[model samples]
Target: MTKILTTQNAQITTAAVEVKTLTISGKQVTLSVFRQLREEPLLTEDVTLNGVPWGYVNYHPDKCGNHRRHLHVVWQRGADLLRSTVYAPEVAKFQSVWAKLFIEAAIAEGLTKRSAESFGISKIQIWPHWATHPHLAEFSYGGVSFQAAIREDFADAYDNNYVSPYVKEKAVAITGPHGDAGSIAALKLPVAEYLAVWDALTALPHLFIAV
Candidate 1:
C-alpha cells in the first residue's frame, strides 16, 4: 500500500503528496514526494538516509533564482551540502539520476553497494563522473586552468566591472599562467557542458575516490 500526506504552503498549492520507504546500503530511508502548483508546476522530494535528514530533489518549471527549471539534486556531505543540476527531459532520466546520486553518496559514506542493489538501486549513467577521471587532474583548455588552485569570488563583478550573466552573483575564479583570473563562464562552453564542468570542479574533495 502507498501512503500519502498533504501539507499547505502560502505561496503554492499542494497538488499531491506521497511517501515511500526505501532501503539503501542496509539502512532504511524515507522518500517524500510533494507536487506543487504555483506560477509553474513543480515537484520536490525530501529524502532521508540512514535516519538522517539527507537533502532534497527539486524541479522548477522555469528559472527561479539560482535554480534552473531542470532537475536539481542536493545532498548532504558532512557539514556542507552539494548540489547537481541536470537537464532531464524525461521522467526515466530524473529517476535514474536520483538513484545514481543516492548510491554514489551511500558508497562514498562507507556503505556496501550490494545492499543498495538488493534494494533495487541499480547503476545508471546520466552524466560524466569526472570526479574519478584520471585525466581530470591534467585537464585545461580555452586558456582556463582548471588544475590550478580554484577559488570562489563573491564580488559583484570581475575586473573592469564586467559582470557576466552566466556567473550570476558568485563566480568560480580560475587563474591563468599570466596571473589573470576569470570566472568559469569565460570558458564559453555550452550551458550543459558548462554546468557539468562546474559541478565536477567544485565538488567536495572527499566525495570522490581516486580512480
Candidate 2:
C-alpha cells in the first residue's frame, strides 16, 4: 500500500474529534450587576445534547456536579445563562426555558446549521456534571400544548433519561445514539431565523400559568 497523506483528512479528523466547544461560562459577578436584556437573541432547539425532547423537573439534584446545585438545562455549551427569578444566592434556579435558550444561542452564535435537525438524532442529554451540581427548579405546562407522555415515553418514565451511557461515573444515565455533527454546521444561518427561534422558545413560558 502506498502511503499518501492529504491535509483534508486531518481537517476532517479535527472537526469530528472536536465537534464544538461548549463553554458554559460560570458567572461570579455581584448581585449588584444590573440584569441586562439579551443584546443578542438565540434559537430554540427541539432536542438536547443527548437528543431528547425538552422536559421539566422539580428541584431535582443536579447530575452534572457535586456538593452544589443548579438547574438541569441544555443551553449553549459555553454561554452564560441568567434567568428571571431566583431566591437564594448559592441555590441555582432554572427551567426548560434555559434549555431552549441554550439551543437558540448556539444558532445565534453561528455555531449551528439551518436544518441542523435533519442530521441530529433524538437522544437523552444532561448538563455538565463538574460545573453544575444538583439543581432546584419548578416546571409546569398549562398554556402550551405539551404531551405529558413525551417525557415519560422518552426513557420509559426513567428519571435519569438525560444521563450518558459512556459516563459510567454517573450511575443514573440513559442510553442513546448520536452523531458528532448534531447541529453545528459548516455553513451559517440568517440572523432573522436565529432570532425567530429565540422568540419561539420564549413562548414556552406562556404555557405556564401562575398557580
Deviating ranges (above 4 Å) for candidate 1 = 1-25, 33-68, 79-193, 198-211
Instruction: Residues 118-158, candidate 2: write the lDDT tens digits.
Output: 42312223232333433221211111111111121222212
In order, the Cα lDDT scores of the candidates are: 0.29, 0.26
Candidate 2 to truth, TM: 0.15
Among all windows of 10 consecutive residues in model 2, the one with the lowest summed lDDT is: 140-149
Each candidate's TM vs. the true structure? 0.18, 0.15
- C-alpha RMSD by candidate, in order: 22.1, 20.9
